[model samples]
Target: MISITNLSYYLGSRALYENASLHIKPNQKIGLIGLNGTGKSTLLRIINGEYQADGGTISKAGDVTLGFLNQDLLSYQTDDSILSVAMQAFARQNELQRQIDELLHEMETNYRDELVDKLGKVQEEFDALDGYTVQARAEEILEGLGFSTDDLQRPLRTFSGGWRMRVMLAKLLLQKPSLLMLDEPTNHLDLPSIQWVEKYIQTYEGAVIVVSHDREFLDNVIDVTVEVAGAKLNYYPGNYSFYLEEKALRNEIQKGAYENQQAKIRQTERFIERFKAKATKAKQAQSRVKQLARMELVDAVIDETARVNFKFQFSTQPGRHILHLDDITKAYGPKRILTRADIRLERGDKVALIGANGRGKSTLLRIISGSEPVNEGKRQLGHNVSFSFYAQHQLESLSVEDTLLDELKHANPTKSEGELRGVLGCFLFSNDEVFKKIKVLSGGEKSRVALAKVLLSQANFLLLDEPTNHLDMQSVNILIQALEQYEGTYVVVSHDRYFVSQIANKIWYIEDEQIKEYPGTYDEYEWWMEERKEQEGNSKSVDRKPAPAPQPATTTPRASDDERKEWQRTLKKLTQQAEESETKISQLEERKKRLEAELADPATYGDSKLMQAKNDEYHRVKAEISQLQDEWENAMLEAEEWEKKLA
Candidate 1:
């Protein structure tokens, strides 16, 4: 556990925190939420001892281990493979194992007394720490984070930045420190991998502190929320949903108190002015003045809302067919990302592309937008289809020296200077901010400027990749609203489930070197996924044969009730068998329903192989159901015969 008391920090002339106090409990999942520039990352650094607080007392319980994921650190080199990098977390254990091996080798050669004693102590220490399973644990963590068995042996340098982040995450998970701190940990993760991380954190026994813009991830993983505002920190018990409700109630109370105090101040001033003109009321006026001076003034809380807003204006409607891709095959050397792929997009379609990291979601997007070439495919754009592309790496392409206003103006040459400034103002850049160089802008500011420029292009079809990365919750919601209202085509690749659910009308899922489409919201997609998992579990369970029925003894019954007793026994056995058969049949039927729904998803329509596989599964289950029914009928017939004998 860690406690921060009366902590104060400053960044240049701005006060980041003033006397902020917070207590982090053991095994608590905490979410740090606040507007940009409110010191969320700075606070994390202070906890990790990377940054020293100007004035504060930080206390930690004895010998607590801490691991902090630094987003900006590129210390991991290319020469190291993913497996080796993850295994580095167990360096101490590995060293102990090596020492024990050496000691054993020495004993076999000469049976040295000193070497034997050293090995005993080393073995004791290793056993106490469960050091024997270190390699297995590391591999488990790596695979859970979506690293393929083949990828584990590949050098880290060959991986992209996003893949490198996964390696870092795997190391942290394997280290199993007492406290874990992550800033935007989900940024580099795809949906499936993100789900895997969520499940891992839920089962983690240590405390977790994450600063992220991902609403759904926080909601699923965290139990408490901490908001940094007014140069102080406030804690909210429960998840993000609970925090939102609590914040609203607190804001209402603060607003009422602020208004009441202002009213009282105005009343006192008016009474003093009226009485000061008359000598007889001079004493009364003086008393009133003292009363005003004694009154406690309430300082108004600063507004913490993000002012950036994006609005798209449509110029004209596109043709029926928006885009068409035929036999698209792209690869890098031996690794084929997309192979023999075909897709067609119609106007007014809102689609979400999803897949594991490095599965060509972005590559496919680039090929459609004409930003990247396809190895063997034809990309055709329908008549009157105007497109605006928002690349995930757009930040790198921006000029740091260009002013925000100048950038917007350059993108839209026909727009007047006044029009450009107005657009920037809507995105929270005003007055001196518009004149500031883009190079000096924060990540969030840069994102807003990029989006602003994209909006001005007047393109009907938009392709956005991770558009919500640097945006706060408020800004994200605004963007979602704008995208929902736009009367055009949209193909977005994002990990934010809530945002995708809100705006997308269809989903494109890439798996096993193929792309599939689903026509529905994210909620529907989730339901279908759960059903598929249930069906798989049922199939595995049903592979074994049913247990044999217990046989009745052939010995004669007691003379007083021989016939009745025999009949009763036979009926009981038959009834029990029928009941068991019915239960199994019901379970299989439920599983079959789920499998049918999964097969119905639009994304699966294009894959003939998967469709055939699903169909075959359906038939297999149907045959099983028929067999179960026949068994049930036979059991019922046996029960009827026993009942007649008893009668």
Candidate 2:
């Protein structure tokens, strides 16, 4: 548990937070949200102790631990293997294993009763610590984050920046600290991996605070929402959808109060002005002035910021057939990523390319764009198919020396200065911001500039790979709207379901070296997938094969009274077992916490004999606790099965 009181932070002259206070309770999942410059990441850094708050007090429970996903992979030790780095999270488990080894050796030579007891205790401690499964858990986390088994043995330096960040994420998840703080965690993940993380965080035993621009991800993972705006923090008691509704309600109420207060002020001022000159009414006018000054004005609701309003401008249309690919096969050495894929794109078509990470989604896009060559395929472009390709890596390709205005101009030399400036303004680069060089811009700013250049190109076809990577929700919405209106043929690779649903008219799903096409909206595709999953669940065998063909019914039969009573008795026993197991688990958890705290105390390490006895008892209790947890889980599962049968 952590508490923040009167937290204040400043970036130069801009006040980010002023007297912002928030309390994070155990098992609370909070979504930290705001606009680009509102300091959500800074707040996370302050909480993680990487940055100091200008004025605030942050208090935490004495035994609480923190885990933060490191965004900067450059600081990692690249010389080490990926698995080795992830295994570092299990420092305590490794230490206990070492102690167990020493105790075992001591017992072999001098087999005293106390030494044998100590060895047994140490082995139990090792098991309780999950020392045996540390490597397997690390592998599971890594695989879930999109790392292959071979990649685990590879040196960290061999991975690119994005993959390295995944490794860091794996390390943090393995740490399983008391509090986990993540900023834009889904930014680097694909759709499947993002869903995996959502499930993981939902079930995580500790508190979580996440900052992300992915609205769908936030809606899935967070139970509490915190908005950072107007130099204050506002709390909402539900997920992002609930927060939006509640925020709108509050804004409406605030608008009404503000309007009433302004009306009262105007009335008071008018009365004072009209009566101030008259001698008879001078005293009344002075009282009115005092009343006006004493009134507590209500704060106005914050208005939505100006959004980018540019659309793709095309001078010429492409041929009816924009692009075509036949028998496309791609592979990296021995591993085949894609095989015999055929696709076609027509003019004015908008397609969404989707798949898990490293499943050839981006590769297929690149091949279609003519940026990557296929191993065995032919790519054909239609006549007059002028196009612009925007890769995620291309965001960093803008010349650092070029200003925002110059970048747009370079994208289209024919455009006059006025036209270029107008386009820049549409992307929220107004006045002096247009003069700022690209090198000094933040990642989001650079991304906006890149998008502006792509718009200026006015190509009839567009190939976009992760265009919403650094974009905020509003920007993504604007881009989606623009793409929807454009008459160009486009294929976009995106993980943002909302954006895809708005812009894509068709879906291209890549899975297991094959490309599947669905002629429907993203929402429709989602519904179809859910329906298929439900059908599968219905057909799935539950611990047994199908029954053999039924014999001719001699007579209609039902359960006897005795059989019904026995079934009811069994159900009741299962329910009772579930309740009792839950109670015991809670009590044992409390006792385990107390014992852990005592063992963590520095004074406990001073006396070897006393420490040994306490540790032996601690390990015994922990082993029992593990067994009890297993039984508790089984009991709950059995109870649910019985309830389902009764239903």
Candidate 3:
């Protein structure tokens, strides 16, 4: 457990955190969320003791170990295999292992009672520490984080920065310290790897504090929300979704208090103006003036929720069909990416391209954008179709010496400065920020610049690769709004499920070296895929053998009439039991949904005891529903058996 009391941190003359207080309990899962440049990562570093607080105190036990997985770890290079690097988390175990090995080697030459006793003690400690299984455990975590089993033997230096970050993540996760801190852990992870990490974090015994922009990940893995705003750390007793609702409620209260105080100030000023001119009520007016001076002002709540109003102007509307790829075959050396893949893009399709890493989603986007030539395919562009491509690598292409205004001006020279400024404002760059050089911008800032450029391209079609990367929740929302208003076709490749679910009208994935399309939203696509998988599993499990040729039905005393009647009755009873169980599950599900809605209310969060009680009830209802569903399944199976016996 750790307690940060009245913590203050400053960046230059600006206060990043002022009198911010937060109590972190043991095993508490907290999501540290805020807009870009709000010092979420700085707080993490402060907690990890990389930086000292300017004021106040951070108190924790001496033995409370901290495991930090940060972007700086990406630069850590080692010739050691990734497995060895991850295994290094077990420092004491490794040293014990060395001692045991040295003792065994010495024993080969000289075996003594003291040496034997030492060997036994070391071996006992090793086994107790589970040192023998450390390598396997490290490999499992690395693979879960997206490394292949073969990749475990590969040198850590050989991987890209993203993969290297994952190796570092695996190392920290394996360490399993008293407190685990991850900053933007999902930035380098694919969907599967993110999900795996989510599951791991949800069950981890150690406390975790994560600074992430991924909404769904936070909702799934974090129970507490700590927001950095107005140089203060605000605590919410629930997840991100609850925090949103709770913040709205608190904002409403603040708005009312602010309005009341302003009205009182105006009334006092009027009284002072009216009576100060006269000698009769001068003392009372002066007293009111003093009262006004002593009154602490309530800060107005500024809505950080962003909406993009800038229309993405295009020169011309593309034809009904934007582009088409027929029998596309793409390969790099012996490694094939796509084989005979066919895909069609329509004029107004908002498509989300999602899949695991190494699946060539970017390669496919490049091929579609005509930046990459296909080895074998017919790539056709519809009439009057123009496209702009945005990728992370495009940030490098930006003129670093150019100011933000200059960058936008270079992107579209025809647009007036006023018009460009308006568009930049929509992307959260207003006034003086537009003059900041592109080189000095953060990754999220650079991403916005790139996205703004794409919008300014005057192209009818856009190919965006991970456009939501490095963006905060507000920025992602702005993008979602911008894409919704844009009158064009775009296929965005992203691992952000929440963003995809919001903006995507259709889903695309790479399977069997072919681009596949699902004509629905991401949520719908997931549902359909689950159903398809279940059906496929059932088909594979079911025997496809031909039925035995039916001989003339022989009554041959197979069963007595009483026996048949009894079997039918048993089947009916079993079916009835299953139906009752199903009904109970449905009721519990509705109850659970109701509780969830109530739990999201700010009033519920105000009461810690009520919050804990509701949470316990919610999870209990979930377990009850699961148990009932399983029982229903067993009952159905029994009913089917009875029916078969009757037949």
TM-score of 2: 0.78
Tens-digit lDDT track of model 3 for 219-268: 99999999999999999999999999999999999999999999999999
Quick one: best lDDT, which candidate? 3
Q: Which residue runs does candidate 1 get wrong by more than 4 Å?
A: 276-311, 416-418, 543-647
lDDT of 2: 0.84
lDDT of model number 1: 0.84
lDDT of each: 0.84, 0.84, 0.91
RMSD, each candidate, Å?
A: 19.4, 27.9, 19.7
lDDT of 1 by residue, 410-515 (tens): 7778788888887777666778888989889888888888887887888889999899987877667767766876788989999999889899989998766667
Best of the two (2, 3) by TM-score = 3
Looking at model 2, residue 64 earns an lDDT score of 94
TM-score of every candidate: 0.79, 0.78, 0.83
| Candidates 2 and 3, the one with greater lDDT | 3
